[model samples]
Target: MSNTPSPTPLAPRRTVVAIAAILALGALAAVLILRSGTPGGSGAEAAHGHGHSEAAGHADGEHHGAAASAHAHDEAHADGEHHEGGGAPAARKSEAGHDEDEGLIAMDAQRMETAGIRLAEAGPATVRSVLQLPGEIRFNEDRTAHVVPRVAGVAESVAANLGQNVKKGQLLAVLSSAAVSEQRSELLAAQKRLSLARTTYAREKQLWEEKVSAEQDYLQARQALGEAEIAVSNAQQKLAATGASAGGAGGLNRFELRAPFDGVVVEKHLAVGEAVQDTTQVFTISDLRSVWAEMRVAAPDLPAVRVGEKATVRATAFDSSATGEVAYVGALIGQDTRTAPARITLPNPDGVWRPGLFVNVELTASSRQAALAVATSAIQRMEGQQAVVFVPVQGGFRARPVRVGRSDAKATEVLEGLQPGQPYVAEGSFVLKAELGKASAEHTH
Candidate 1:
């Protein structure tokens, strides 16, 4: 304060005012530089052309402070206009991208045909409600038989083999048995006595008529002949019971087992020299022209599975199926399984079905008319959607999400998201689904 003269209040005020003015000028120049260097400067310049012209006219008359203020206002207005123009095109682009992402799969007519895409109109259809039950293929009991020898004997010869086809009355095996031999011997002895008895009766009748002998003596001869005849008849019946012929060229004990019907020998338990019992099952024969598809029906499904209803039998181990009628349904349920046994009679003329082969039985529980339906094959599963159907749009096909109801092998009922008369891809729709998936992956990348 001693070395320099005291500054005046007016000088300080003037200095502060000059500094403020310089700062305002510097700020305005910086704003102009920034706007000119940016990419949007051209569009900003055109939009603010009128402001620039008016500013030019006032530049000479306005003070530095006012000019800086006006330039700042113009810079802000230009920036606002630039931002608006930039956002408009961006908004339009975003709208287009959204439309493209709405499950649209672009395809040309030629490409669609090449991919085997076929279309069908959705309309009223009958939807069959099918009840599926587990089952197993079994022998047709009505045409199957278990063969046994009536008398216990050692197997002399076994002519039939496992899996051999035979005709009715075909000799299966020959056995030699003491039991049969005894019965046959009795018949032969009785027959010889019967022959003698007939001669005696003829002589006795002649004597009685001619009075060559006493009446009591002739009566005794006649009684003896009658007793002989009775013994022969009883002996013949005994031989018949043992399945032995009264007079045959073979040994007296030779017993032959014959097939009761035309069938295939599915089982054989006897072999040459093997001793067997009367009750032992020796052979199992079955006529495989028909087979049984047997299943266990639960209490709830018993009503739907009735005699004479049509059912479809499908093999579980292989691709085979047949349609048949429900032949039998048990009147009582099993105490352990709490289910009733049901059977379907399938004509197996080709002999494709075999016993013990597991299968599935499909029965039509009911049927109803659906207002709108599509082929079950037409339905496809997509991410975030339960099911979708491909329908034609302007540029290509669009995947329309659908709510499905009852479904069978042929048709599926549509509960929503479809209309009658609307055309949709029925066959080869899987091709379209694959295409859609590929498009989504590409877009994601």
Candidate 2:
């Protein structure tokens, strides 16, 4: 080997190799520092290393290959996670946006007016606790009459038909009866006898006064006249008691059945030429200007029902309604239904309340003062959940769930979820609910 002063070619080659290895290490360190400083710098760094590894020694190449493989694995995992988990965040963001847009009904004053959407404020009110009972319209028993002939008779003519309106004392039917004829005939005979007795008595009294007849003869004549008068009076009463005229154009046997009062004939069992007994109900007449709304009150509700309590009767078959008082209440309960019968007398001047019409009898069991109440029409049902009221907000109305208590025909008691003086939809609440449904459906799509 040459001295230190001589030229050293091998040494220079060794120096070159060392320098290359040093440069490779430096580059690798630089890549690691860049990757650490900027997490997204790995992709460019990996590409640069891939090309440089070809020129570097095998040892450097192997190291670069390991680093690049590790980098690729990390990149692949990150990319996969980004692709899979990225959808979750985006989906979550979209759902959040939809959630914020739900249950919002936008309406203006003009739209509300056109839709008949009226608004009212929730405030203190008297809520009547109403007890609804099923009932039926019936003939008022006090105004109904069952007509019967006083004597067995053959009906000569039925002047009145079913459902005929008649005045008091109007002839309903004419009947022929042998029993009635006998009474009238007896009266005629007694009257003839009385006429003769009266003349004889007058002569006797005059003769007695003139002393032209014996006193005993006069007394006997007077007694005979008195007895005849009694007999005639008895005959007249017998004919009158049977509701028969002593004499008629038709015949003495003709008996007239007349209406007791002004009424409508609801039922007729007698017809021309029909034989009827004394107790037969020939007709049923009723004054239909008033009717009875009868209901069966459960034993538990009996205490609340009284003879004079005001009641609202609503027809079930139609939209007819009337107000009445509880005219009567049964003292006894029905064994089968465990209820007592109650009656409400209603004025039906129009005759619209026909018998056998089903109805609902609403009675105010009690009245309570509520801190918050609203019109019953304000309540709306959403998805079969608890009732909700549309409360006015800054822009529109918001559905507010509420717990309800007592309710009446016009107002409802709001137990919760409402503030006094808060405006709410007192009418046309159903329109808001429909609009909300449409909005929700569109968001889903």
**Candidate 1 local Cα displacement, residue 41, angstroms:** 24
- Clash pairs (backbone) in predicted model 2: none
Candidate 2 C-alpha lDDT tens digits along 52-97: 5543443432444544545665566567557766687899998997
Please report how far candidate 1 places residue 162 from its true position, in Å: 1.6
Off by over 4 Å in 1: 1-91, 94-98, 206-230
Clashes of 2: 0
- Number of clashes recorded per candidate: 0, 0
RMSD of 2: 6.5
| lDDT, candidate 2, at 165 | 98
Tens-place lDDT per residue, model 1, 1-445, is: 3788776656455445444444444455455556466664564454355444444444444445555775676677578668976898999999998887667888898998899999999998999999999999999999999998989899999999999999999999998888888888887888888899889888988988998878887888888888889999999898777666787558877889999899999999999999988788999999999999999999999999999999999999999999999999999999999999999999999899999999999999999999999999999999876799999998889989999999999999999999999999999899999998998898789
Q: Give the TM-score of candidate 2.
A: 0.79
- The residue-level lDDT of candidate 1 at 46 comes to 49
